[model samples]
Target: MRLAVVASHVIQYQDPFYRRLAAHPDIELTVLFCSAEGAKTYHDVGMGTTLRWDLELLQGYDHRFLRNFGWGEGFFRLVNPGLVPTLVRGNFDAVLFMTGWAWLSAWIGFAACRVARIPIFLYGDSSYVPDEKSVRAKLRAAVMRALFGMTSAFMISGKLNGDYYKHYRADPRRFFPLPWAIDNERFVEGSAFAPGERDAMRERYGIAHDELAVIYSGKLIERKDPMTLLRALARMTHPAIAVFLGDGALRADLERYASHGLPASEPPSFPVSQEAGRPGGSAKSRAAFVGFVNQTDLPKHYAMGDAFVLPSHFDPRATVVNEAMACGLPIVITDRCGPSADIVRHGENGYVFAPGDDAALATHLDALARDAEMRARMAQRSREIIATWSYAEGVDGVAAALKSIAGGEQT
Candidate 1:
């Protein structure tokens, strides 16, 4: 079977899934990315991650970009729908759309596949909540209702996400929970961390050998609630340092609030990572704003922490939580994180706090910080849980689904 995957951004991270699909001798895959000149105008983060376009990754498959095609976003769509025939000429047996963020791409791709009578599958973790936009946006959704209704199947991440599609009037029979992501072997290999490497990372980050460290990694955004974490630390008494990973618009505010001990904590025993590196010896910032840790270096970063904590205000699903768990780092995540439900085993593996519950979040933080034995046990359990779910299993599940669709399985 020939499958054409449509996306809007650069898919450098999807190397594993694409490689798996490419390796299938029975399946020929074509990845269609949106043009970068086209991407500059697209403002959706979800759309960018889904499309994985413009920027190319060195891979074995034939991936192409359709820049001339006008998307409703970035560039206003034109009436010239001739691109439909061009995509159809690829003779794809199935069309898998990566997301709905780009209405032009999803809508046009769906239309083109329908013109060719090819089976279509939509893949994403989005819920069907109205954006409260203008009347034209509402009409666009109405058109999507008609088009997506014809989907052969869907690859969603959770029951909540599945219900989102059902609310859109999609066929329940076609709704399937196929979670996004599998550990890239590259990440897994990075997980083969040597004790010396961990020690080196700790030294490089200037974290004391015995400091109760809780690391928060990811883009520093309002949704991530780095400030709330600071507030939570304000309620705690443990002498823990928060290693803030990733950069975003809130850096200046976060850096200013990160004075002395972390939120929910007593007093800090040591200086902040940056302060320690500095001469004045006053970086006592709880939120050490170490921005944008590289993807390849994440394992080393996670290894530097005694535990992981992400107090996102409410992320649909913080994949970093999964990455932390995969790295065997016990986590203190909020209920807002999707992976918390599956990975966290309450007191067994880690603690979960309600979003923005500074007091409650402080309690969990103290539990992990004060009880060293429990922290180690939880970290061990994190790795064990990750072992049960391998990238190979995720790939097999995807391949089986594709094969089932080919075999005329009922929706």
Candidate 2:
């Protein structure tokens, strides 16, 4: 089958499921991008920037880049005039829509497919259970209900996300709960380095093996609440080392705090102390602040950790938490994180601390650090729970829905 994927970026890490859909053999895929080439990078999805998304990756897929008019965004309306004819001429079997911003493009594609007598399957923003219903969300929900009722089935991350569409009056049977997917091969194969070789690895990076390694892999900005992790670690009066692997506007402030932790003898690599605002009180522990890490090289660092922590103030759905869970790492996340709310069973799979509660975070951190048996129990559960969320399983759910929809075509 020939399929038209409706979204902004054609291929990237931000939309793993869509990318896999493109790579699937049973169907041929075409991408519809709404934004400019280099305007923004969604999540860690490097579309226009990275060559890793070369010809090899999108070999079987066709690409179409949409350009906006006069004021750029405002010109999107102009493209509407030609979008339908263009899609109709492509002779696509179906148009599969994704991304929230692609709402207009999705509408245009939907119209074109109807006139041409082709199927259209919608995905993305349609899947999530918006934390709350806003005036805009209510309108969107109404529109999606209408669109979904007419089109083929779409995908959702889980039961709750799909239930949102039904609440907004969408047909629940047509809303398939297609859980999130990840590259299982990467985690399963792992990096060249092994856990026992951590000592040599630390020495290569000029870090000490004796020092406790606390790792945080995400943006340093407030949304991620990197400060909370810092505060929690700083509050703990003990021997520990903290590593940060991401960058943003907040770099300067975080740098200052790390500098203070760096020994005076070593040329202050990080800031000595925050001039604008102190990290506040004694640093919970020693910190090593490094900028963003490359995805290919990120796993080794994750594997070389004592514990993985993400104290997001409020995250939509933490995918990296899933990555950590798959790697058998003991996690410490905040309740505000959507993934933690759904996956974390509190001391079962992993532990969840109250948002902004440094004392509570520190208590868990200290407890996990001192207790090896508890960490092992949590780690074992992590691996076990993650096995159930593989892309194969998620795709099986999607395939069943697809098969049901496509049945009786020969008749």
Candidate 3:
């Protein structure tokens, strides 16, 4: 089967899965990237820095970048005039749209595919969270029902996302669970450090052997809520090390909160490193702010930590949670995260607290710190759970959808 994938950009997490799908013997995949903004050096407002992905995104895939008439960043800004003509002439048996909202290119592709009588597949990560009750939201949902009716199949990220599609009147039989997965091999390889190597790496990062190291990665922005983690850590009396990876606009504020009791007007010591035996220093001083670590180097950082925390105010589906799970670290995520239900087995693999609850986050951290055996048990469960949510499983879902479509059974 010849398949065409239309996406706004090549994301770090999705790129690997696309490559895997391209490698299949029965499927010939062509990815249409609307913008090369992420491939080139672009300033990410979330990370608060310019980033060029270290990994090769287009290496092993049959792909092309559509001509982008410059508007600005994000999906709504993307204007590709050539998208419809390209899809109409590409002779693809099926077309998969990464997202249908906020992109003119995606809408055009959908229309062109329908006109050509080609099967339309949708892969989206949208969840049924922050339940909107406004009239605008209801009107949008009604419109979404019409749009989703044009598709042959819906490839969802998780159960929550499946329910979101169902909420828009998508056929349950046509809904396939193409789970949100990461490069598990890359993360597992990164986590497999020698005993002495793990100790040395932790020591270099100011994390002692006895202290529980709690690590938080992703953009240090307010929505990600890294400050909540810091505040929670500050109020804790437990002996643990707080590590913040990545950079953003909230850096100064987080650093101030980490060092002092309040957010103050002072330049933060970039990449602060504190030793174990400092004169008149407490465990709180062990908090380190390590700036952005690239994709290849993130595994070792995960290895150094006893647990991973993502205190996001709202996240559609955080793929970093999958990465941390592959590294065998128990997660502590907010309930607002879409993958929390699928990835986190509340109090089993990790704890899921309500968003913006600093005291609850602190309590979980303290409990994990006090018990070594529980951490080991949860870490084992994490690896086991993440093993099933792999790219291979995603391939199976795509194949099943293709088979169902070929059989003329679009329910």
Separate clash counts for every candidate: 18, 10, 0
lDDT tens digits, residues 308-386, model 1?
Answer: 8888866765677767877778888887676665657788888888888888878888888788888789988987876
Reference-based lDDT, residue 175, model 2: 60
Candidate 3: worst-modelled 10 consecutive residues by lDDT: 263-272
Give the least accurate 10-residue stretch of model 1, judged by summed lDDT: 46-55
How do the residues 1-411 of candidate 2 rate in per-residue lDDT, one tens digit apiece?
A: 666766654443434454566666666767766654332343433111232332223334466666643234432532444557778898766666665334456566677878887766656633345544688878866765676667566566655466555766666666665555456457644633765676655544434444456678776777888777767767665445567766675666766755564332222233333331125543322665556666566667776666788888776566777767766678889876656645666888668988899889888888877777887898778777777776666555555555655633411
What's model 1's lDDT at 380?
85
lDDT of all the models against the reference? 0.67, 0.61, 0.81
lDDT, residue 92, model 3? 80
**Cα lDDT for residue 220, candidate 1:** 75
Runs off by more than 4 Å, candidate 1: 36-56, 68-83, 127-145, 260-283, 388-394, 407-411
RMSD of each: 4.7, 5.6, 3.8
Off by over 4 Å in 2: 14-26, 34-56, 60-83, 101-103, 125-141, 144-151, 192-196, 204-211, 260-285, 407-411
Candidate 2, 211: how far from true, in Å? 4.3
Compared with the true structure, what per-residue lDDT tens digits does model 3 show for residues 125-158? 7886345599987787777888888778888889
Query: Could you tell which candidate, 1 or 2, scores higher by TM-score?
Result: 1
Q: For every model shown, what is its TM-score relative to the native structure?
A: 0.82, 0.77, 0.92
